[model samples]
Target: MNVGSTSTGTDALAVLTRVSAGYGRNVPVVSGVDWALRRGEAWGVIGANGSGKTTLIRTLMGLLKPSEGECRVHRNIRFGYVKQRDGLHDLFPFTVREMVDMGRMRGRRLPSDRDDRMGQALETTGLVGIADMPVRELSGGQKQRVLIARALVSRPDVLVLDEPTNDMDVAGEQAILGLITRIRAETGCAVLMVSHLLHAVLQISEQLLIVHEGTVHTHARDEAVHKDLLSSRYGIPVTIRPGSGGGLSVEAIPGGGGGV
Candidate 1:
């Protein structure tokens, strides 16, 4: 994968304008944020609790209407979304395969082709062996992978995830992160993920969007800038050290860069 170059089709994607949104009749949770998601770009949105991270994702999904600015997804664009919470209820009796197959049904009428796509998605997410497993029976990580597979089965041009690694162990987190990198390498689909895991986000994200006080404070791909902003925002003293292969390592400074 050419990490230095943006995806070839990036120019074809839509530009999100100065979008603002909030709950009904309440104050806006996000405002005056203008950003664009290019095809095959991987972006991470980081912020503290109540920082409107999930709200931003919801607005992108068209589940919430923007109260201020326009959000324009390009024509013919196809997208898949994974929410922080499992929207699927536990009482719903669906197997992993069945749930994944539903993704393909969203935009097509051909059942056979949909099934084929579902199979491919399962393979992509490494859930092929557990195709017959019940959704509720899978572990948290497995279930999250299934959700990702469900999103991929539709063959989206972009994938959006909110707090995808929220309730998982270290191994689970690593597995999901690996899957994300592999998927991007294989499919070249754009990814927009909202996560609080600063270290993990820094590892894979090509760009970072920092939201604070209902607005975007910074947007950049530089590792040093991201670490500095995160350290300041979270009150964690952060120091950047050079790593192997020209990467950077971030360490928290004792009793510094830490405060709310």
Candidate 2:
């Protein structure tokens, strides 16, 4: 699942030029940001809590306008988002398949195509067997997978996920990671994911962005480089060691005054 060596396609699908954003009239969470996402690239965003990682994603997704500077996505690019929480309501009483079908209504004008896409999406996410199950009855991992399936059902050019592996066990984490790898391999869509688990991000991301003090402190494709930069920024020594199931264990030095 190491995508560090993968090359992004020629065209830049999303660009942020000196983008700064915040709610109300408050100071921006991050400022002077400049970045680009090319087609078929998988980018990882990492930072401590309240480091504006969520704000940056919101700006990119057009949920919040920049207070200063600009943010732009390709005119032809369509986005699918998977939030940290599934936000499923019990009142709706939608089946798993019906829930996934909603993604197909993004911009489609034909109901037939939407139905076909939903079916394909369920199969793609390996949820075809339980397509009729109540969403509330599924396990946490299953629910997350269904959310991803819903995102993919739109066949968007860009997919954004916020903490996609949250609330899952190790096995479930692996399953989700495997699915992301397979999806990228099959669809070649651009992906931007926010993750707290550096090991998982290292497994699948081609590019890494570290946000700090309301700005992007580092960006690179090399995991080693990212590790070094992270350690330096936090004023601590971070050592990455091999862990079970080929994951990584990050050891941080004590007495480091680095802000989380």
Candidate 3:
């Protein structure tokens, strides 16, 4: 759960102490997860599809009641959530600007009609030119950018992104990742990214968290990920190598290649 934290002093934005979360009255999907996310840090969470990554994220975001222990965020802290692109309805009627305006709803102190923030978000996300366009007609990358804009409009202290580059082409994916990197540098906001893009995640994340079963394994930026552990958990031969972009790249041995 630790994002861009360094050995030196930095304030924590959120902390989870022996936490567990799941649907009401059901077995917990994730348990005993203890971690802290510090301000101005970037953390990447990776795991198999059903390994409770999403559930853990929901717990951290306070969208789900923790079945055990505690999940705490700093007082008055704001969060920005960017869901997977597939979650956006293609036929939704809202225009891009109007859609981005919806982000202001979560800010209790913000004026009800904070159009300025919406406008700034569009500009920041490079959607100003198309702000008036129908959301359904936008390209996949454009749609994802709109979602990012919505999240940014609130000036959140922490940004949570789930598969932000999903359904995008290579160019689109690179563009979005680059945008996120730039945003993190500019705003100094803690970023929590959950994705299957191991290379991309490693490139920008200061810390890596790998979830297996109901537990978590944390690694610092310089620590190596255990290939055998990943292979065992995923039932495939996972390997890591240096990427062209100066970060470690992860791949599965052929019999079928996929990330957990």
TM-score of each: 0.84, 0.88, 0.88
- Report model 1's TM-score to 2 decimal places: 0.84
lDDT of each: 0.75, 0.77, 0.80
User: How close is each model in CA RMSD to the real structure?
Assistant: 5.9, 5.4, 4.3
lDDT by residue (1-260, candidate 2, tens digit) is: 01121223448877777788878888889888888888898888887778889898888878888887767676667788888755766566679988887787755474567777887789888998999998888888888888899899888788898998877778988998889888888999988889866777777787888887787854665744445777764446665677545977555655554422
Model 3: per-residue Cα lDDT over 71-91, one tens digit each = 777776788999987889776
lDDT of 1 by residue, 127-210 (tens): 999999888888888889888998898778888888888878777787887888888889899888888666566666888877
Top of the candidates by lDDT? 3
Off by over 4 Å in 2: 1-10, 107-112, 223-227, 234-237, 255-260
Clashes counted in candidate 3 amount to: 4
Error of 1 at 120 (Å): 0.7
Q: List the residue pairs that clash in candidate 1.
A: 235-257, 235-258, 235-259, 236-257, 236-258, 237-253, 237-256, 237-257
